[model samples]
Target: MGANIGDNLFSIFNSMTEYMIDAGQRSVLYWDIMRRRGNQYLEHMAKNIPDVLKFDYELLINGRSLPEPVNYGLLKILPPKGVAIDNRKRPFVVIDPRAGHGPGIAGFKADSEIGVALSEGYPCYFIGFTPMPEPNQTIEAVIRGEAHFLAHVNELHPKADGKPVVIGNCQAGWAVMLLAATRPELCGPIIVAGAPLSYWEGVHGQNPMRYTGGMMGGSWMAALLSDLGHGNFDGAWLVQNFEGLNPANTLWKKQYNLYSRIDTEAKRYLEFECWWGDHVFLSAAEIQYIVDNLFLGNKLSGSEIVTSDNISVDLRKISSPIVCFCSKGDDITPPQQALGWILDLYQSVDDIYASNQTIVYCVHEHTGHLGIFVSSNVARKEYFEFASNIDLIDCLPPGLYEAVIEKINYDTVNPDLVTGNYISRFEKRTLDDIHSLGCNTLEDNRCFATVKRLSDVNYGLYRIMVQPMVRAMTTEENAKLMRRLHPLRLGYELLSDHNPMMKPLEWAAKWVSEHRQPVKPDNHFLQWQTLYSDLLATSLNIFRDWRDMMTEQMFFGIYSQDWLQALMGLRASDAPPRKHPGHDPVHLAFIEQRKKEILAGMDKGGPREALIRGFIYVRIPEGACDERGFEMIRRIRAEHHDNHLSEFKKTCREQFFMILLDARRAVEAIPQLLVGREEAGQKFFEIIRKVATAPGPLGKEADMRLAEIKALFIPVRPEQDEK
Candidate 1:
């Protein structure tokens, strides 16, 4: 009996251990399957993703046969539905960033920037390139080509009222700004969405990406990487760096979310990945110049950069109205980087107005960098409102205005649906508001100066010792192979019969679908899963936050220390003091003359006549209402039976000509016109009331004309205001 009991106990323990081992194996298998299944799902989605977006984009050249001019091309867009063909506005040009992606994000949906413009009866032109730059095409060459493209657009729409509005997104933002600065005459309003200008300015712990250069020893790594690529910098590397910044999203969180709701989320993930996966490349020279000069060295904002022909590129030289669109939640190009340039270049708001520049900015509270340009909701609201109200912005006075778009009830009847009544109120902002965003410390500027010097040394060393070997090893065939074998591309391409594990996944997917037991939307299991996922994401973010803080602290500590500053010959203050250089005498005199002419014209007429003219001018459409307003002036001339009417015509003609000569001048004179006219109208009303009530019988014709004039000057009735 004792022997039997011992044997039974040993058997029971063995069975228990076996069961434990089986459970452990099943858990491991489940996790492994989850990862592979997620990847497989992504691959399937990528392969089957439909091109929901339609663009007339002409492919200029295949990167494989590059070195030559474009062999193929297509127009990126066609006119939208429902607009009459004859009256369509000139095409507006929009260029999307090719930083780590292909194009089409700007016009990817019906509620996109391009789409909004199209809906407004504007022809849309998109500037997009292939996955590679032309073999010998430099950035400067591309800039010249883009300028030529704009000139062509101008020719195509010769009768259009204003110049084409060119919008640049992300990396294209700076490119468009450079174009405007260099050739301001070619475009009208320039919109730069989410572009970084003052690269070195960032909050201490919040923006850690700026400190990456200092943490990695100041662009030496960039030089080495370019050398390794044999005189070309693979933009995929840049894409990887972007992914590294948000590891939770790039690694697990994003994929896990898709898995948890794979039935619905698959399409969205694939749409984004299409652009994200299509990596582009930049020549070593281009990437190096951008890094050493703009990113790490911070030269563009400092007025230290020069073009290839040795021409100075100044931001202040851009004469056209600039619209800066930035978002607070955008980690890539935060509000600081977007608005900091104003503080770097100007001393005060007066400086900006003195230059006759209209700089308007709009800040979205919580959109991410990509969402600023791509989110349909944002595109519908911000972009649609911007396109419709661009003329109002163009006509704003020379100063800073924060553009605010408020939605209106559409049920209310209005005259022109296209010109729906919008309450556009411009709030004044000062240079100090812009400066407080992230104007850098003196120590920050000095450190960047040191970085510029060190970059030159590192680049020279690589060219002399390492570049030649790299060039010899990188042949066209090998480059093609390298592209095909890239992990991101290969991961999708290798999931067919080529992978043995994929065979079982097909069966598993079917089985899982057939026997699927999805958690209820509000089930405790789902709630727990969500809580766990949030915890994981929070942990990853905390790690990233800490890492960034450490990186920034280290950078400031090393570069700001007195001993290190001395060794690097870096100054702790801003550059040597420079005297204030005033404005050009010729331009100042011209502006003063224009201002005087407008003021003089308003002073000539009696209060009632001046008020009538002001109201007429504001309401009438340009050129269209020229006849109507001029007719009213002529009627007053005949009826007054006085030389005042004749004198008013002469002054009106002169002031009108001054405005036609320069739109900027005309807009600047509006406020003074409005103020003077209001005062004159009040005075005229008082005088007319006294005359009418006086004892002498009012001249019948004079009384009638006066009544007619008063009717014209009266403000729109409250009932009419409702319309």
Candidate 2:
């Protein structure tokens, strides 16, 4: 009994010593993290002292500031290897979002937008800005600046494929869209990733971030804050808003995650923290324009916002093809917000077609908003496929399509036909298809319309009763102090190297890291620590969900009132139904004229024309199209083209539209295209057969379409092998 008691005491002492050592080590590491973070913040502040971009841009295009103006310039990005661009290759211009963060997140890394384009041999250019906007620089000026930049890019790549494929991330997405709408001739295929064009549209209960604006009153707060900043709104507020959306991430998981895997996660955590902490500021007018016109008023979808020159900024006017990359898991810019504009702009699929526009969308199942742009997996598959097929997308018959990317599998029938690790198929979609994702936004939009009305009233009252007094008391110096005091900013400042309190921490951290005593994974105490962390996170998440639900309920209860909605210019029953622009006589004449031309050319060019027509006919049912089939078309076009690649693309587009308008006549004219080229006709049949069977076995609808096409081309289908 005495021996056992003595043994227990010794065991207790040993355990206590181990606990103390591990605890000491952890405490030192915590201080180390804080110090490193502080140092990083200071470094970022030093670089942004001049507020110039730290991006390693090799070539600067001093944009001719045009009649209006811009303080920013465009630059060509040389890859890390510093390879000179092949001017003859297609030029890829990427515009990084000027939202809160510094530039180069899109390209500085190997797994990024610029990186993908560069690997594909495209001459890559990036549109980035300094920390400061030109005095009184409005959105209009920025748009004009971008237009001139594109013109310069076009001039620089005179021998390259048509025009630069412009890629815009987040805020840049909508900016590019506006630019494309205003100057469609300058853009090739415009890609908008994780951008919310229709802001008021969101799912109920799940997307509660939309309700916060209404619950807290409205844009008056934003306006007042902007006035405080003396015409510049600190972007730290925007980043703060982003943080609030996921408190668990910002408050707990982020720090705890770093703590739990400190040894392995240090480098990555710091890299991301650099981007997250480096906040950028916006002009007061800019944020107001964004909040009022885009977010609250939701005026963009209907072309309510006009250009400086009085042109109505209608999306339908943009003739360039557009590809929207959104994600279902993105709470900020949900698929509904990303794609709801299509429902707003067009009455039907026919309307989209009549407008002579090509809009394709790809909805990722589970990537978050940042992941849509920042994830390497997304860049590898979706972006890589997009870069490879921009030309095909550009030339696709004027219609709506959903570009679907799926992993290639050996089990997929004839997998050898797929050249890459993934296959992207441009399957045609319609307004109804998009509507299925989130058609419930109409009611939500009505509630937001009420909020917008309230904002105007509140803002007017603030201007009259409150603004003068607030402005009198606030100076630029005080405003700077206030911005620095922001919680996100203050945390870094408190933990910074400048703090005398953290002086001893440096020595302690160095010693602890050298003599680290990490807790064992299976330690009971460590397990308890993990359990406590999880319980805290879970409880917070539950509270968040409940809060979201209550907010959603309150929003509907307050704003759903008929009197409130009617007062806000909405109908008692519903908001105004989305409308497409009415077809003007001139537009109708253009369409009639194109139809007439297709009708006239029905019985024209031999085998190639008929073969192309056959292919188009088979794909009338959207599912009939596949990536491998398009790949086949690409090979045939390259092999068969006699002139510039553009000529072949144009020819195919014209022919495809002709067939789309009148499939029976287009198919009937098959023999006409095949006249005097029986050998070519046989080759065409083989190609179509390959296209139909590439992704998988043909379904009934496609098979029937293929059968009709095959019967028409039986004379061309070879009966025996050539000797």
Candidate 3:
């Protein structure tokens, strides 16, 4: 018994000693990681918050020098070694979100949106902003500046196949739509990755972030923050809000991941932190407009936001094909918010058709908001497939569709026709499809409506009661001090060399690294540490869920009261909590005029028209289209015609509408289209046949359509013509 007790004591002592050594080693490595992070932050700041784009770029147009004098600038990304840019191909203009952090999240790495465009031989450009805004610059000015940048890109690549493909990340996504709506001619195909146009949209139980405005009493806090900052809203506040959405990730998992994998995780952690830490500023006017119109009023999708010059912003004005890439895992911009604009703008899928708009949306099941733009996996697959098939999307018939990308399997038909590792196809969708994802009910909308009304009241009260004193007390020096001491920046400041306490840490960390002795994987203490960290994270997650539940309950309870709704000028039967700006008369006239033109040209044109018409007719019955089929058509067009992509798109749209208007007349008129070009008709039918078979055997309906088209293309011999 004595010997056993002695052995137990020795074992306990040995375990304690090993734990201390391991703890000491981990502390040294963790602080070293923090020190490196601080140094990176300092370096990134010293460079004036330059973009994190991995590729080299040359400045093209500086928005500060434009007539609008905004802080945005356009950069032309240079092709890397062994990459050749084809000016004839469409250009890609990637706009990073300037919500809080500095730009370049869109192209933060080599395998990113910009990289995919460059790999596909498209000229790439970036629109990034500086850390500081131009004095008195407004959001409208920013939109105009972006428009000018796009026009310049268009001029630079006059020989390109189509207008520049504008890609917007997060905040930039809505900005892209705004630009496209106002200046429709400048945008080609638009891709909005993790962008939220409908701010109030979310699932009922999840996406607690949407309720934050109500919980905080609305835009008044934002106004107060801007006033306290001396007319500049600190972007760190926005970053903090994002972090607050996931307490487990923000409070424990992130740091613990680094602490546990100190040997291998520092570089990536520092790289991402460099972007996250270097916050930017928004002018007071800008934030006010964003919160008032977008966040509170939920106006952009409804066409309710008008410009200072009295021009209303209408999303229906945009003619480009819009591809929204959102993720189910994104708590920031849920798929509902990313796609809710469709339901807002159109009452039905037919309205989309009437507007002659092509909207394609893709929802990723697992990618987070940042991953939508940053993950190398997403870049290699989604971005690559998107870049390769943009032309296909652009040429699709004007309507709603879901872009479904699936892995190639053994059952895949003609797999060689599909490019890369995945095959991309667009399946028809409707507003019902968006509704199925999840949306706010009438009661939820009424609650938000009340919040908006109360927000305006509170904002006015703050402006009258608090703004003057706050402005009087705030100064540039105080603002700078406040920004420095922000919780987000405090960590970097405290861990940096500037802190005398941390000064000794540099050398000590180096010494410990050289003499490092890592604990074995089977170490009992190490396992216990991991368990403790996980439990902490789990606890935080539970707290977050409970907090979110309380917030939601509070928001709904306060805003959903009948008295509050009545006070806010909203009733059960009055106007909807929000009303969509009905169709513009001029837009209606334009659509009518387009219909007249389509009717006039239904039976016009010769081989080109017949070829495109036949392709549409063959695929229309299937109710789905794939990039493989579109690519085959593009190759056929390239070999047979020299028409520009814009012209081809125009003809395709006209033919599609013609067929939709009168399928029997459209098919019967095909013989007239092939009156003299019978040989070309045969070739076109052959092209359509190849495309139809490339994916697999067509459905019965599609096969019948193809037979009808083939019969139309058959020439009558002189001897048999008498019969």
Candidate 4:
């Protein structure tokens, strides 16, 4: 019995010793990861990485000194391995937000925005900036510079099929919006990913970030910070604010994640940190303008912010198709902020059509703001589908539609054509459909307007009382010191190779790696340790929720009161209704004008024209359009594509608008376009028939349209239908 007891003791002792050895190895591995991360971060920072583009780029235009001088460059991205660009394909211009971080996040990896474009044979261009703005480089100059850059891109890719597809990431989203609005004729389809145009918009209980401008007593502090920086607003402050928004992620979660999976996650962590750590700066005037006009005044959508040349930036001015991509999970630029511009500009769905505009939106169920641009999965799915079917999106009728991307299980789209892994479909949506998603009430508007007014008052007060004192004390050296002392910077510098304290870490880490012992899957202590980490993250998130709840309650409690609102020049019952000018005669004039043009050329079109007209007429009933249907239409069109198709596209687009204006009357005119070309008319009908039958049974509205097409173009013989 004593010998058995001794054996049991020895077994227990061996297990304990193995566990300790594994624990020691893990500790060494962690420090080694940190050491490597520190070295990677230092190297990245030393490189002055701009254009956040991971691929090679040649500088095309320099903003070192010019009339509209800004510290930005227009770069043409060199295609990576296994990818060759076709200039004939639509060119892609990706504009990364210079909010606080440097550019390149959009193109930093092989599976990113630039990557996606390059993979699909599109000539890619990146508009990014140096770390600092040129002397006296205002936002106005920046916008002008960007406009020039795009004009240059258009000039370079003169052979491209359409205008360049401009993608705006975050702050760059608004900049692109300005470009599109100001120079609508220069752009193709616009993709705004996580771009927040309407800054004062948010769900009251959910997105508490909007209340920040109000809670901080307005943008006066921003002005002060800018002045203290000696004319430049450190983008580091912007990065700091982003980090503060998620304490759980910043304080515990991100580091813990790296620590837990240091073996595998080290590279990814270092790569992301390279982007996150290096920040860009905006001129004082630029940041103040952003804060006052956009965040505080909430003026972009209302056409209140004017260009340097006194041109108003009205979204309605843009003629290009716009694709808004947002995420339910993005707290920084929520769906409301990204999409609310539509509400502020157009009062109803018809307004969108009357304005002769097309807006397509796709809301992801769970991607964060950064993920919209950076995540490979998002690139593979959303961006890939978008790049593939851009022409179809461009060809969509003028109105609002929701792009639904679904995973496909079918091996083939047709007998010979293989299906892509995913498919994209646009479903017609109404103004109410968007409203159901969320738009703040007039009362909410009043509160935001009050915040705007208070900002102006506070700005004036700061100008009088604080500006003189700040300007007197501000110096370039102090500004640099403050920037270097920022928490983000301190973390990097402290952990880097330059720090003597981290010297022994390299030697120790190398020794540990050689004698590495890893914890087994069944280790009880390791399992408990993981559980503890989860608890910490959950607890921090819970605290964040509680804190957000309190901030929201305080915001409403203070702003929703009647007497206080009246004191701020708002009436107790002052809730102005947002108007829709769609039904107004002036707005309706465009449709009338289009209808007249269609009627004028009603009898002057060939097989292509007839096909487009008949196809459009058949789709006048909303549910007739499907992704598979569009794809089939595209393939058929490709078989018959010519320079004439461009004119035909315009023709189809005009006719489609006519159908939307008055479907009953538009259908009557279908006979005018198709009656002369009987053989082509029959062919067009067959094409429509194929598309209609593509997605199994025809939808109800589609069935009606199909019957109408058959009535318009009945074949000379029954066998023609078999063809």
Output the number of the lDDT-best candidate: 3
Order the candidate numbers by TM-score, best to worst.
3, 4, 2, 1
User: Per-residue lDDT tens digits of candidate 2, residues 1-723?
Assistant: 999999988876776677678877876787788888888887877773322233456646553355765645788776557645566667999998878877777874677888888777788888877666666678878888899899989988888866789999999999999999899989888999998898877776777777777887878888888789877788888888888778888789989888877777888777777777877778877888888888887778877787668988888888888999999999888988889889888888888888889899999999988898778998888889898777678777788899888787757666555656787778878788998886555666667878988888888899999989888988989988988898888888789778998878989888888988776776666777789999999888888888788889998999889887777677855525444445568878998998898789889887767776777777666453566766766666667664355666677777877876787777887877776775565567878877666666676787898888776676532545453
lDDT (C-alpha) at residue 189 in model 4: 96
Which of the numbered candidates is closest to the native, going by highest TM-score? 3
lDDT of 4 by residue, 1-723 (tens): 999999988876776677788777777767666666677667766776444467898989987655767898889888877887787887999998899998889988988888888898999999888888886678778887888888998898787788899999999989899888888978999999999888877886798889888888789989988888898988988888888778999998898887767568878987888788877888888998899989888888778877767897889989989999999999999988889888878877777877778899999999887889889999988999888878778777788999988777655344333245776778888877778778788788877777777788889999999899999998999999988887878877778677888878888888887887776767666677789988998998998899899988887777777776676687856546223222446646766776677656655665666667776765656442456776677677678666333455577677776566566765666666665576566666888788666655665877887887787776346887677
Q: After aligning candidate 1 to the native by TM-score, how far in Å is the CA of 149 from where it should be? A: 0.8
lDDT by residue (1-723, candidate 1, tens digit) is 999999988876765555444334333334334445446434533542222245434433232343334211224367555643333354678887867666678887777888888878776777766555655456666666677678877877777656788999988898887788788889878999999887877776676777777767666577666555555567777777788788788777977776566656656776665666666677666677778777876666656667888876677778778999999888889888888878777788767765668888988999988899889888777887677666555545466777765544555222122233332334567887777666566666666556555566666776688777776777666666776676766655565445666567656555555654544455444566678888999899888888877877787787667666556665545453221233557867877786666555543434433444433233222111111123333344456653343245334444444443453444344444435455444545544443332222334554554455454444356899899
lDDT of 3 by residue, 572-665 (tens): 8886776666877887898889888888887789877887888788888778889778767667767867648888888889899999888788
Better structure of 2 and 3 per TM-score: 3
lDDT of 2: 0.79
Report the lDDT of model 1 for residue 301.
66
Q: Give the Cα lDDT of each candidate.
A: 0.63, 0.79, 0.88, 0.80
Please give each candidate's TM-score.
0.74, 0.92, 0.96, 0.94
Candidate 3 structure lDDT: 0.88
lDDT of 4 at 249: 93
